[model samples]
Target: MNTYRLQQLLYEETDIEKIQKKKHNFIIDLPKYSFNYQNGLLTLNDTSFFKKNEYLFINKHNRYAACPKHCYQFIELNYMFSGKCTEKINGEKIDLKKGDILFLNAGSKHAISSLGKNDILITFLIKEKNIKVDLLSQTKGFLNISMENITPFFTDIFRDKQYHVFRNNEPLSFEQTLNNIIYEYYFPQIYSAEIIKCNLLKFFLLTARRSEKSCPDSQLEPHNSILLSQITEEINKNFKSLTLAVIAQKLNYNKNYISNFIKNQTGKTFTELINIRRVAEANKLIKHTNYSIAQISELVGFSSKTYFYSEYKKHFDHLPSHDRQYSAAEFLKV
Candidate 1:
């Protein structure tokens, strides 16, 4: 079916939604998990809802149906395809408009207000295992920490099970990617699964890039903001040989001052950021190219294979070979 047909399909209310309208309550069978939401129990949607071997589930949120407070067993991404919807996540109310996107991690307690018939919200449930930290490692505000230390960062953001809403400043590419995924999902063909995966990766990469670049210079001190812009551009372009000393000389700042400024802003030492950049680039090559591990290490500016392996493992918690094996499996999977 085409996308227009899919839209027509989504506009039609389901039997469950019809029943819900009569009862004025969402009556879906949900796990009885005890959660304190305004001193009430919150339902849990466990992994049992997913079939075995399924990594992703996509559907349109019911129109004119108010979903009850519930938490999920998997991560979720929601796109406000049209119109608007209001949702309360962990006590915070969020209003999402057309082209906006919302990301909710597993265990985020949320309740959706009733949606209008014109509202079209697309929901995607992704198994937690499907997320690759390497992709998000480049996100701003995520300090360049080793894999061992990254857990603490995750804990900070996810401890509250917070949800993030990103307004679609530029919607063409974002909406096109979402449309492509929905098309492949509703109209499956040979290699559709792989296409969905590729589109999902692109979706995440675009999100990361948007988040990284969305930070306005007005948010930072004027001098520091300009310095940060220059420093990041330098590192992104020349991470191979870029050092705090080299950056300091290029920017005409004291080496110690540059080091301290980087640490203060990102909570990561200058060396850690460079290594993280190198490892992130190497991971991209490992996943997308036929370069050998040794060649990738050298290409990313790691002088010694041993040191490269050490840094890569620290960031990914696995040898580069693991990524190669995983890529091979994905390629050969039916």
Candidate 2:
């Protein structure tokens, strides 16, 4: 099912008052239970929940107060399926809209605001041990680190302790990948665990790539960063007919200055940057859709098929047809 339908089903099946009542019962009924910040780790004490065979657990954020300011023992990947919510992290309030993802590491303390009726927030809780095991399994006997050292190793890999927020303007692919994971999680078919792992890895990699672009290093100046963002956004919107002169006139800057600024900031000229963006889109079309190379080239703003092929090869180091064939082979193998 599509994301919209899935969200509709989730909302229809979930009773907000019942969920709130459950939370209230847990707090009042159990004397030892406390969701407060100083109560240490918020261990979800559901015995039947998160089976040992399962690597991930899916939870729906349906309450108005959500949860108290607490932390978990596992990493949580929060995806905004629909509507909006506010996340208070590190003294900053981040307004999250549809298609946004908030990656919270283990032991990170944060709180969420009240969610709207249409707000469909899905949380994917991944066990820290599972991730550490997966990483070490690849190398086998290459490293002799004990279980006690695993958490520190993983922490070193992710040196930035702050939470990460990724804004996905176009969430079609993101939604599709998430749907696959959710499907696999609910319906346990043969090799479903393997499939979920693969899909989650793909989703994580895609988010990491997008995050790198969205949150760049601090070396970029404030003014240049703003200008660079505007330039890229304009190029993405009008790549079909985008040009340095057109961008300069639209942004009220000189053409030469714009060209030089782009080159200096991105390390690529205006034409080169546009070509890169077009070729990237063309690659996606060639792999995911059945569009011919010529048609895909034209769709991505290339006027001549010959020039498109040259630029495509220059960027990807392979012909479009070969790439398509390779992708098809990989899909069949899967």
For 1-334, candidate 2 gives per-residue lDDT tens digits of 3555555566763555466645642231223542333333244432333666455788777554455455666677888878888886644578888778777877666667767567778888777677556644643675565433433323432444456666766542476688788776665689877777667656655655454444444468888888889998999898888988999999999999998888777657899889978988999999899887888989999999999999887665457998899889989999
Q: Per-residue lDDT of 1-334 in model 1, one digit per residue for the tens? A: 3778767777788887777767777665434452324334354454444676566788888766688777676777889988999998745589999889888877666788888778889998877553445334334365453322322212333432366667876743588788788989888899987777667666765765565454344357888888988988999999988878899999999999999988877667998889989999999999999999999999999999999999987666468999999998998995
Candidate of highest TM-score: 1
Q: List the residue pairs that clash in candidate 2.
A: none
lDDT of 1: 0.75
* C-alpha lDDT (0 to 100) for residue 107 of candidate 1: 67
Q: What would you estimate as the lDDT of candidate 2?
A: 0.69
Clashing pairs in 1: none
CA-lDDT, candidates in order: 0.75, 0.69
Candidate 1, superposed: residue stretches over 4 Å from native? 29-39, 131-161, 171-173, 215-334
TM-score of each: 0.55, 0.51
